[model samples]
Target: MKIKNIILLLCFITGFNTAFANEGWINILNEGGNNKGILCTPAIQKAIEKASKNGGGTIFFPAGNYLTGPITLKSNITIYLDAGSVLKFSENFDDYLPYVEMRYEGIMMKTFSPLLYAKDAENISIKGRGVIDGQGKAWWNEVYRIESAKGPIPETKYQKMWTEQNKGIVYSPYYQRTIDKKFFRPAFFQAQNCKNILIEGVTFQNSPFWTINPVFCENINITGITIFNPHSPNTDGINPSSCKNVHISNCHISVGDDCITIKSGRDEDGRKYGIPTENVTITNCTMLSGHGGVVIGSEMSGGIKKITISNCVFDGTDRGIRIKSARGRGGVVEDIRVDNVVMKNIKEEAFMMNLFYDKNTVEEPVSERTPIFRNIHISNVTGTNVNKAGTVLGISEMPVQNISFSNINIQATEGFTLNTTDNVEFHDAKITTTLGSSFKIENSNNLILDNVASMKPIANTALIKLTDVSNMMISNNFPMFATDVFIEANGAKTKGIFLKNNVFNNVKKVINKGAALNAGAVVE
Candidate 1:
């Protein structure tokens, strides 16, 4: 299908009216009903209610600064802002009180409030060329202070005292419990369990917490949206938790946290929910200055599958593409495809697979890890100024298998470091390092390096190191380094090693004259 036709099909599938859609526009004027430079939340809500009653339409905010309180959007509504529309939140924290049904810290516990909310709605949207500012300095500072205190703060006293002090409300089952889950107020826009929704062409800023959260939703389409929140704490942009059939495209996200996070649930509660977030596609986006550009499963206990991310740019982030899951997560993240990504100035690893995350919790250093990441393909990538090229920390039991990296050119501060088991393949991949060795393989096996090229490092770095590896093939390889290759196989079974049509420069000689290097294991 052609691109336009595909988009049209997506629109049709997503229930978007290309034409003949009513222009439902709402304008909030001052008390005197003058149409400029004022905030009228009550008036806007009245307008939205009136419009919804009369077969829903768009609530338009014209080009001006309109300071308002928390407004609830109704079903069959589209809130549109004209260009230059600046919808500012009221600085008085009391305005967002009484709490709501929200998720905090991976728990379904509720507290405080969100800036804009729509619950159990159908065919809703918030789109336009405008800005929604969440005035989040007060809340972000509080979370940071709590985190720095180090001890578990009492949830009841905290929420009650904060509410009594900040003029908010406490609405959690832990409302009676002393030790409650730390609940910070949510971001500029949060919707729960809505269907056939869209949020396009809006600029969200300075969120109190995670921005644009769509939880337990279905058939959602978010396009042409720009989220910019540089506040502290959990200010993630576009977290689609437990949602199915979500498509996010043509968006620009630059936040203090993860740019796009996919979560099924968190910890035990997620496993109990047992609803896997599946069939999501993210394309044509630019992510900058986040913890991870596109992340999945730091809180993914419920399995996630069938995700495709293409034609994206990850710039100035801590990580480009990351999949992080800890030990207790009994979920499988499989069948993912990432193509045509361009990354620059990645502060950390360009591609990271951390199956053993948050080592602070696991006291005895878990050697046997799971949560397999298999049959994943990443291709047509060009990266520069990468801190680390790749780090795969797979399980000792089930190594990350059937993974391929093809047509990749990366220039990084450090090169590939592989740990644990492996049935990995690196085909048509080139790496130029600045500090570390080209490849470091420890306790891995059945690896194939086909048409791999490594540029000589200016620093003293080794070309390749294979320790306790079996059944490996290094054919059609070209490497440049300042030292020799090291292959040390302990009491492990032996398979053939082949080094045919290989080229090495600077100072490298073949030295794997062992029995494990038995069949097709010849170096020319």
Candidate 2:
């Protein structure tokens, strides 16, 4: 105990601020850090292996509590956590030993070793303002009793060699109950095939699962981070699977599932790891009570491109900008861009694109596993107290094409629903609903409603409600005053309904052909 009397006896018992006693800094209390909290993972893995064998620098963790387990970060490392540090992670499920090769929630094998791990490393970093505690409620109650099969299914040979290397390449009965719960937990920081990664200003809390999980990484930067797992079931916050040039900014997430999620793996092992979670950027973030404040894919099979979400803010999030996949997850979510978002209290759908996310109904024939939500663009978005002011579902043999919504505003209680979507375009949109029809088309086709509007029209519906829709164009709108009908043509494969130069204010009727329309379907 002579590293200056163990830093003057743990700095007079844990006030520990010897101002980082300068020396090319590798001080985890001179590689012994035991202010009596005992199990100091070999003095913080020997101060990150003595700063990766004296080539890299700063493995410092100044003020207190470093109860550890698995902390491995090699190449050119930096894991500095100074201000009243608390890197406590050890819920003790065999101290995360003997199962390594990571990638959970999108399936690759061998688990339990990600309490800050790194693989194929390159200039890695995990920066300051310390907290990083994953005392995750007994690993979410033994993975909720092995995913509700009610406990005890552990038959180890490393769960029979990880069920013969992740069985038949993930087809899902929830991936055989996560290999019979033998891979119950792991991930509260994972960096695989890493390169130039940086996680700045940390806080990260109780997460036995996903909280800053990076896989197949490249140039990554997560800034001003603060994640708090609200309930910790799946606890996802910043999950960048199959990463590419990524950047998430000014963060503050409240998680228990999806507060920033994007994937590119799963299904035929993510199309045999074709590698694509492309050039991403999520800017100015703040989302609370997560379940999706920017979620893409229900495991998109190796394809998710050019994503850019801007100026974000969501409160009490349950859904705000979600793009989910299905039909065996054969991915291609093209050039997505959601800008200037502001959502409030949204507990359902404040803009969501669903390719039938689950309940895989037998509809095969459109090859490559058929899941594609095309060239997305949602701009200047705003939602308030939303329950549902958005739902674009496609899957009548792969539809959901070219989605576009510009300067949109929503106040929901149900409105803005499309089905079997196609070239969707709505510029300067406003959906203020109290119930139905503020644009609720079905079996859609090239839908374009420019300068659209609706001001709480839930009277007798019809502010636009077509069915079996076809190439529709409701030109330059924005003339409201309640409504009884402003176009409501139904089924029988509704024809190219056109309403040019619209300005019909106090509407009582403006076309409501319900009897399976024919004669010029709907024209005003």
1-524 in candidate 1: lDDT tens per residue?
A: 69999998888866656344534554455222233546566787788888889888878777877777788888999888889888877766667776676755455655656788888998998888998888787777776666576686655454674444434332323233323334457667777788998998999988888888877889989999998887466799888888899999999999999999888776666776767788999999999889999998777767788899999999998998898876666577888899999999999999987777755434333332235567777899999999999887776555777777888899998878887756788888887787756677777778888876666544333456565666788777655445454333323444455566666554454454444444433334
| Tens digit per residue, CA lDDT, model 2, 1-524 | 47999888876765535544555577777777764556788877777777778887778887877788878898888888888888887888778876788877776877668888989989988899988888888889876665776546656454565666555545556466456556547888888988999989989898888889899999999999899988778888998998999999999999888899999788777888869799999999999998889899788789899999999999988998899888877879899998999999998998889888776566888977888989899899888989998888988899999889998888888888888888889988888888877788898888889877777676777878888898789987755676777778888898878888877777788777888777786776
Q: lDDT values of the candidates?
A: 0.75, 0.83
Off by over 4 Å in 1: 1-24, 30-39, 150-158, 161-181, 360-370, 457-460, 480-496, 500-507, 512-524
TM-score of 2: 0.40
Q: Model 2 has how many clashing residue pairs? A: 0
Model 1 TM-score, 2 decimals? 0.84
List of clashing residue pairs for candidate 1: 24-58, 26-60, 155-180, 497-521
When superposed on Cα atoms, how far off is each prediction in RMSD? 8.4, 16.7
Which ten contiguous residues of candidate 1 have the minimum total lDDT? 170-179
